[model samples]
Target: MLGEPAAMTENTGDTPRTLRLRADDNVAIVVNAFGLPAGTVFADGLTLLEFVPQGHKVALVDIPQGGTVVRYGEVVGIALRPLPRGSWVEESSVETPVAPDLDALEKATRVPAPLPPLDGYTFEGYRNPDGSVGTKNILAISISVQCVAGTLDVAIRRIKQELLPRYPNVDDVVGLTHAYGCGVAINAPEAVIPIRTLQSLARNPNFGGEVMVVGLGCEKLVSERLLPAGDVAADTGVVRLQDERHAGFGMMLDSIMTMAEARLEVLNRRTRETCPAADLVVGLQCGGSDAFSGVTANPALGHAADLLVRCGATVLFSEVTEVRDAIHLLTPRAASPEIADALIREMAWYDDYLAKGGADRRANPSPGNKKGGLNNIVEKALGSVAKSGTSAITGVLAPGERVRDKGLIFAATPASDFVCGTLQLASGITLQVFSTGRGTPYGLAHAPVIKVATRTELAERWSDLIDLDAGRIATGHATIEEMGEELFRLILDVASGHKQPWSDRWGLFNDLTLFNPAPIT
Candidate 1:
């Protein structure tokens, strides 16, 4: 169904064009980059009554007041007033519909049959002792409190400059610093989230199991607590800046660099081996979305997700607010009744969290989303859910929880790009695929993020930033299946270190943002 426009001009010359996803849909999105002006007519005889921006929808049929505005074969909104055919469907003229009731939904009734098993696919990766594989072999230094962040930053620069060059096999050294640990309610029941997130993050496969911790002696979260118990290597070391052994900043720096070199020695000996595709754990997310998101980028990403699932890989899709309005479509796809309940439970918890903050799902779509033609959260949710593909939801993870199962998972996290990426990293995703419409330069320091652009124009403009151009689907140049296949291959190439995403090539890594829901003292 992708790349098949319902109404299009015959010639390749500049003319008005629109794309309708389904036969019953009464609205079609304008495809021209600069938009079509008033009185411009389409091949199917639908004329524009007013200017409709690119990616914005136009009514395909006359509708009375309070009539439903259909897109993607679903009711996205209600007409604010009588809308004549050829009228541009502005965001203000549409009202969001009520979300589906959670308690009344069916459970696991329409689980999709598994796709054919894909075998003989493999990537070169580093195999850790704990049975997890890593796409990169890097020594990660963890911090227990924010107080040591500056000290760790200084030490990391020295390590990267003086020590890293000595180890050719080791990829890079990263200091895992965050805003948790001190000056907060560490004993609060909700405090476990950040604590466990920090603990799990230190064990990320990319770190090559060489975990080292740095701490200020008096922080509530001690250095030992941040290290993974029973999994830490005998040589796992911790450096305390407040220790009596450190007389000054110079001694503190020397201590950290000394510990870092030991970890690098271990990590440098690790080498990439051929591993099955099943070893991959990937995260799927989107931001700066537009109406074309569902039509192109998301669908293509969905197709790739399906392929990953078929290959026995673990794939995670998140963003609770983005999934809330589309929960109705996902419940029945749960692999079991238990999985369905887990999905609903996460949704309910997030609902309460938002309500406590005096916010609602309507607050999700940003101004960029609206300018990109996402009128409301309802419309955005419908487009956002397309990245899940048709795979059955096999597992669920609460925020900050490490993954225990290996399949299509719902890792509940906020919609913020940095926060979601952080949580996904904590959940053990070694690679991430982020799709955007309006464009973003988000990348992860611990993993490779493959950025996919929803429109060709943005991709062409930011050629160095975007890794894949799913926008070709909207331009009738590529099918979703083709793009999906290409993306899957690219994922393997990147994971194997055969190729590097633009973000990695440019070292455009974002800071680690911890989601601390508990009260901060």
Candidate 2:
């Protein structure tokens, strides 16, 4: 079932809508665009005692002072004062609850029954020599310093215009550029984060192991430092701009183009072969969230995520602050005690990081999130973590680290859309599923972003932008499982190059934003 109806029927005066997630929950999110007026009635016979803005919470039952307000079958906040039934529960009406202590968390207490194997699913993918598979046949050029980005972009455009057509097999050329290589304290302990991010990103599966690097020779980060040792192919692909052999910018372009062609030759010879679903590395995320996000889109995506796990694929769930509020609920679902410990470690590290900056998890739930009816981070997080589904978290990766294990892995990253997407790419995600209620034109150059809308109205309005619609689940037009299956099939098609997501079709790509926690000077 798709839960209770979200909108008022014709009999009710207006379409004053509300969405209740769980039976025990006392709050329901408003569904209509304009705030419903007092006396508005919902399908469930719940009358609005006061105006409730769209996407904000409405009290379904009386909440006494300090009483818990539940959502998602969990306590999201404590009522600061008495709240009568039908009252709007704004952020000021409730206080965020204390975070669950890390040491006392339950471990492996709610392991879900193994889902039936989704067998026989395959995608045509470029197989790499290292046993990894690539969804795109692109020749990617890595840059060792920010100073080289301008030169590299010019070179890439020239290559794409003059050289790419000759290599019919290669999809496109992309420069792996970022703001990290120079003018920073290179040896700072925190500097390792960006270094590793750049290093790992150079090896993303989409690159097909044909990695080339453009460098300003004297930069703190050398091309050799970004590529692994004994990787003769990658080492040979490095083109140093400041090398004596490059007399000027024109000569530098010559060297880069020469190196790029060599990699293109290797990438061109590669062909797509049928690969099992296990070869997929998918990243799950949510932004511009609203009440319907968890009720429809996120849960639907979670179901799809579970299906991917059943197919033995790797799925990554990230955004540190987004999940911090639900840490207590997640640690127990860890695959093992060690994995549970890892989850806590990442959470604790992020907590300390926030404290040092004189902030806390509450700083999340951006202005757009609030406008979409999420009163605070607690409520937003309760919905955000749903993208992970019910699968046991098999592993945890720190910010910018590479993924090593399969199943649902938590890759720690900031909630910023660009930063999260970039770090996920570094962690080897070949495809990304981003659920949005308020909507954004977020895209990445490194991977195809499959945008999903949480509401029907938004979907109909942004038809050309959104790839999938989980809103049907809320409107009773589709079940979460049906949407999930549809998404699963779409993932395979996109990964196989049989379909191009809207982001890719329009060539919409956001810049690669590196997460640099250390000092820049």
The number of the candidate with the highest lDDT is: 1
RMSD of each: 1.7, 2.2
Give one digit per residue, the lDDT tens place, for model 1 in 371-469.
Answer: 999999988988888899989999999998989787799999999999999999999999999999999999998999999999999999999999999
* Tens-digit lDDT string for candidate 2 (1-521): 12333342332334666767777888888767677989987766888888888778899899999999988888888999999999999888898887778778887777666778888999999899888888888888888899989998899999999899999999899988998888999999989889999999989999998777888889998788776667655348688877888788899888888888988899899999999999999999998998778888998889899999999999999998998888887887888888888999998888888898898688787888877877778888888888988888899998889898889999999999989998999999999999999999899878888999998888989999999999887666788899999999999999999999999999999999999988889
lDDT agreement with native, every candidate? 0.90, 0.86
Global CA lDDT of candidate 1, please? Answer: 0.90
Off by over 4 Å in 2: 1-15, 232-235
Report how far residue 327 has shifted in candidate 2, in Å. 1.0
Candidate 1 regions with alpha-carbon error over 4 angstroms: 1-11, 231-235
